[model samples]
Target: MPRERHGTPPVGSRPMMSIDGLGDLWDTLFGAQTDPPALLVLITGAVALVVVSTRLPWRIARNAITIAHEGGHALVALLTGRKLHGIRLHSDTSGLTLSAGRPTGPGMILTLLAGYVAPPLVGLAGAWLLGGNRITLLLWVAVALLLAMLVMIRNVFGVVSLLITGALVFAVSWYATPQVQAAFAYAGVWFLLLGGVRPVVELQRLRSRGRMPASDADQLAGLTPFPPLFWVGVFALVNLAALLAGALLLAGPFLTDAGLTL
Candidate 1:
């Protein structure tokens, strides 16, 4: 990817708050070439990978299960007299276990619900949080996770909640420049919400429309028109967009003054 030259944004080269300037923050000394063509290549490559993954059936199913599984672990811990430790998401069904004694029957039931409750709530919160700059994204997510953990402090998993929050912030900070990091930060926040919030909202809407409970599978059965192909298209577009954005900036384009940008 074309990287920004290592210096403050050049005088009048671009607006500090502009998208081009923000995008330029992804500039690097690690073989970064500011040539418009190279920048376009990086954007295209990044977009393709992301879109393809999103459209995969396995990926979607696995993420769905992961959502539930996280809740399960928290719920089970609560019921079993085990301290609810923070959840760890893998690429498959959740493993709801605690670091302490096993719970009785009622405890098992609570553990199950923990997984269920977390996803939707977390998602709903995320949608509202990601509407701004990188710092806003980071702070919003951190605050949300920390607050949620605090509410569940009696659970053993509370401590790890902060750790998880820290990890995300670190990931974005380490890999991204101010602008690119901000973009990923926005996506990360939305990903949490979409995984939980959008699904629940859809479920509610479905129920209201049909006057019957929607039968979302506990297993990986949810499917819509977005297939592997859909993801490919999305990534392709993102890369194109990235190139366009870069070109516009290099050619002296102006970004909207609004504080939002990818």
Candidate 2:
């Protein structure tokens, strides 16, 4: 019989598969984590509120909202059977998504309407996931969306913004502890819920001042029988409803644990 070589496995002895390793990976991706303390959840909400309310921080953080906003347009465009050309994110926290289809139709209307409503809807979804203790799944899903959005970015700033955001989310998902991931996910969802309202408010303000004549609301108005202000009101209503619903989902557990009713 031939001698076994040094550092090699003995004859007919193959490396065994690691059931423990696979179990760990599955748990990391899909397992439910312990709910974070109520105080931490409230603190994250407060932090997100500050970012949305403050001027300088909002100027920077609004980029994330812009990503979701444009992504909404892109998604709706595709769903409506339109051809998406590209998307651009500017440094001013404004973005544009280009798609080609019938110049006037329900598809076009829905695509235009999707931008302002997307963030809060996304936040509500995230809140639902967190309510189920799928914190890791939430972060991973965000990273996946960002990666998918990266393919349609049409400008330098958009690419840089997406890459940075994706990197941060991926880092947290891959390396952070469960507690940290939960906090980050909660903060992000809170931000989206709160942040979603501001843009509609701003849209109306800009429209009143005649500053943004070509805004989504204005475009929707031109396409449909409704006026610009009407569309703006629609956006406001949807976002506010989403905020309220998301709040209940996120805070209901804490309230219940405290023996309080909302």
Candidate 3:
């Protein structure tokens, strides 16, 4: 970790939006380290932990993923002309999004699709930011989104979850060392990228046994020509692609340094 030294420019100097001000801001937020080694360490640690999260029975990690999942549904609902009622987070790492809209239409279809695709989509966006070395921006964006979700959180659990997550993100972005901030950003991205894949698999399993009555995949099946299993496969493929792409973005510089291409 490195610390950046900052001082206000002399009075009557360049405007805040000038190049010097922008550079100063960037340095203040991210420090001056854009080295390959630091990035490799951050990316490697995040990848390893995300891999473990997938295999281990970690309740908290799953819950975090669930919040993102439900938040996705709520966000899409509002975006698609639906009146978002609220979000409910359950203890079993499952969630529900309630909204007011046409029962059958494109809005409903997109809202249903958003949940399964949200985590990865978020991960992909995070990956792009991390790839560009915008660690502070990543944290701020995360905090903003969490705060937005907090407003629509109806249940105690959802409120607590959003508060805790938002506070932690804000705290780190404002106070943590640059290296620690980068590490947290990487971990969040990794979790989003990997956590989205498992639920789709579980959905397919439940669909096979006729246990999932109104799962997103089933809803998608009814809305379109694709079968439930086919939609499940689509979700799986999208998540897998997201995971791979995020990984590549994080590790691409190192690979290029090693004379590798993929």
Candidate 4:
């Protein structure tokens, strides 16, 4: 009897693996999932709120926000034609994004402004995706962004942080059940929306105390006519507005189903 073949398939044979993978990728990117229960949404929001409000958890969670913060700077810098050098994330949850370009221009101003408001803006985008029942898409998009950011991380800590965060997101998007994915996605968006505001508030406090003199708001002040406090107020307003808008998008369906309006 001929030995049984246990090797690779002959050329021109059906490429089932590639076909199946493409199908899976298509579904994962564009599939519409059922909405998570309203209770789950509320619970996630509550958990995110507690995390943001509590100091210890906030310290830990702030790393994620810092990622978004620096990412925002890097993104805007590139968008505005600045040459992005790299990004550094610190253990203290602080981050620095270095870029080279015209020092005093609209591009520079926008890049400086991007850091403080990036989280909430990103949260709003996530909320919109969730509202459309694209939970998996949101998760995968996050993972993709992290992976892209990882390429530009200049410091050991930054690379490690991105790797950890990206791994968590990829694991959930790949291995977790739908319910688990939904929960994780909602909680993360909630955290971003809620967590985004705290840093701006902290910046104001530090600035008022005459600390953090060279902060983003101060840098913006130097380029523009506005004072540092004025820029801080602008950041607060944008973040707060994003929070409100994101909340409405995330909760609107639940409210409508329950015969409510806000």
Best by TM-score: 4
Instruction: List model 2 lDDT by residue over 152-189, tens digit each.
Output: 99899999999999999999988988789888999999
TM-score preference between candidates 1 and 4, better one: 4
Off by over 4 Å in 3: 1-33, 36-57, 259-262
**Residue 94 displacement (Å), model 2:** 0.8
Q: Model 1: what TM-score?
A: 0.36
TM-score of each: 0.36, 0.91, 0.82, 0.92
Candidate numbers sorted by TM-score from highest down: 4, 2, 3, 1
In model 1, what is the error at residue 60, expressed in angstroms? 7.7
Compute the lDDT of residue 119 as modeled in candidate 1. 44
lDDT of each: 0.40, 0.90, 0.78, 0.91
Give the backbone clash total of model 3. 0
By TM-score, how accurate is candidate 4?
0.92
Q: What is the lDDT of residue 218 in candidate 1?
A: 19
lDDT of the structure predicted as candidate 2? 0.90
Backbone clash count, each prediction separately: 19, 0, 0, 0
What is the Cα root-mean-square deviation between model 2 and the actual structure?
A: 10.8
lDDT of 1 by residue, 100-139 (tens): 3433344443443344345434433332332222244444
TM-score pick, better of 1 and 2: 2
Candidate 4 per-residue C-alpha lDDT over 129-195 given as tens digits, one digit per residue, 9 for 90 to 100 = 9989999999999999999999999899999999999999999999999999999999999999999
